[model samples]
Target: MTSQGLHLIRGVSHAVFRGQHDDRAEECSFRFWRCGKGFEISVDGRDVNHTEFHLLWHQLVDDNSLQNLSRFDKWFRLWSEWKTLRDVLHCPTYTLKLAKTGTDMRVAAHLVAGPVDKPAYDMLPVHVSDMDNFAKGLPVCGSESVRPGSWLGHSPGPVRGPDGRLYTLVLCEHRALDAQRGEADMPSWDRIRAYVHLAHSGVDTHCIPRLSSLVTDGGLVAGVLIDHIDSGSSVQGLVEAAVSAEQLLSLEHKLALWRDRITLTVTTLHEHGITLTTPEYGSTIHELNIEVNQHDQVCMLLSFGTVSIVVGQAELEHKTSDMDELRTVFDERLPELIVETRRRLAAA
Candidate 1:
């Protein structure tokens, strides 16, 4: 659907985010399309302007056009697109109101349940099929799939950052998740989790990963930030924690910590021999990165041991992997982090 064509579903998104967003962001988006114009709703909610959204949207719609904005100024351009879309359509701002179900989640149940007759599954052409060859002509590093600095398990598909860099959105790990409730094409929790696990923690001979683990095992995915309560918390605990963060932190702080924690955590997880390249469990495991543009609220991502620094426009991911015994090293990483925090807090 063309950007201007999105006006048809502007009201549906308005209705969905307002009443049903609480039930499920994905579902609301899904069902909103049952009203029949999905591409329109997504284009509108993504709210990027016609020209800019067109640049990114075109990449998504054409499987052969996916460009890594990291190679260009994508992160920034995404921000511009969102702003333009919002102003042009005048969408009511997307806000988060707390719920009892999770630390962080985008799908809601009730709104999705009501009148949600099945909308035929029409997957957003999120990937640019074999776009790699075509992308080489562009200025950015042309890769088939972007080697994300950090894999944040948010939702499936893609996210165009404020910078204009196109990010494949792998939503936070799902705990007792159900995506069928909505109208649009939202991936199952398992699909998303599989993607994260395979994408970031790829084929490792020693680590026998299981897709079932993402669904039922004590395995948890923190959908948003890393706060004190969630530092040692289980993945199941993260859902509520994420909701609280929306209530607690400002937009800018949230975005910063999202990038910070994921960058730090994924670098640490790699030592276990996970390359995030396999398919069996591609997008299942990940620490998500959420960046809010708002100012005021402040928070710190739980960067236990690793410290990240930006060398220039590019952020260098650095860590110490010289440890001989991997198990012994990971075992102590979190324990020592807790002790250190206590000491620092006491000294303060």
Candidate 2:
């Protein structure tokens, strides 16, 4: 059927671009929706650079439609045969490329979750203050807490300012400049090194859906994207300052631990054909890069130290790399981190 089908994600808001699996990947369009936010995506259309949004769809798609094609009609019959032959199916995702303006265009159907699942997170007082400060500055970015807020995780009651404009900070993360969150036990070195850029509080980490795939234990794992040209996040600048701060040496123990995890990651990467070898870490800033060969294509990278996994890219990227080797690193080691962290807490 030439006509595309749509799937509705109740709380996360948006109709999935359930389209015909054919050569015209560009023809597949999507509608993104969420709390007071909405947009559409397609080739040469509006906002082509929303890479993460496309990722969210690929990682989280409602295939309930798979059961609805009951008609033995010719259209359904033809489509069924095509679906059965597809070795790898995609859910949905966006990839922003350089537009005519030299800026990346977000091209994807991405929407905010109406009854969004903004989970509670742990945070420090100092961090919360920064998030509040950022919210005040970026009047157009994300929704801020009504009164109280945090240094980690999403806030509540995102409202359109009386300015009568509708804008949302896609997704952001709030943690230390070099901090990362995942199943706590042993940090997956390669995964951690995948995305090294730190996020500010209140910045939607799911901004572009980069890290939504691999961590989908129950569909909560996703990474945020940042619109550098348009943002209200002090976290980016703050992360830079934190890294180069000589005082950061005071947190040496934490840094050393992070390095240990990172080192293990690099070694493992080498063992598999993936190369993360690059720039010396003389500076505190993390400019790490993860290069992997996917489907015979070399040097596909994401942010270093980013512990996210989406299905599409990985299918193409890791298809040639050592998947078992990589998965073993996280699968076996993550549990260890969880146990050790608990032990430390118990002793304390």
| Highest TM-score model number | 1
RMSD (CA, Å), candidate 2 to true, equals 22.9
The alpha-carbon deviation from the true structure for residue 266 of candidate 2, after best TM-score superposition, in angstroms, is: 0.7
Predictions: Cα RMSD each = 21.4, 22.9
lDDT for each candidate structure = 0.27, 0.28
Runs with alpha carbons beyond 4 Å of true place in candidate 2: 1-249, 278-301, 304-348
Cα error of candidate 2 at position 27, Å? 31
* Candidate that would win on lDDT: 2
lDDT string for model 2 (121-219, tens) is: 211111223433433322221122111111112221121222332222122223433333343321232333233222222222222212211111122
CA deviation > 4 Å runs, candidate 1: 1-15, 18-31, 35-124, 127-202, 205-348
Tens-digit lDDT string for candidate 1 (1-348): 111111123223211211122212222221222122222232222333323333543443442333332343322222222222112111222223222233333322222122222211221122324434422232221121222232211233333333455443322322322345434322333233333333344343121211211111012221111011112333222322343334323322443444444444445445432222122222322222121223322222221112222233222222222122222222453335434544554565
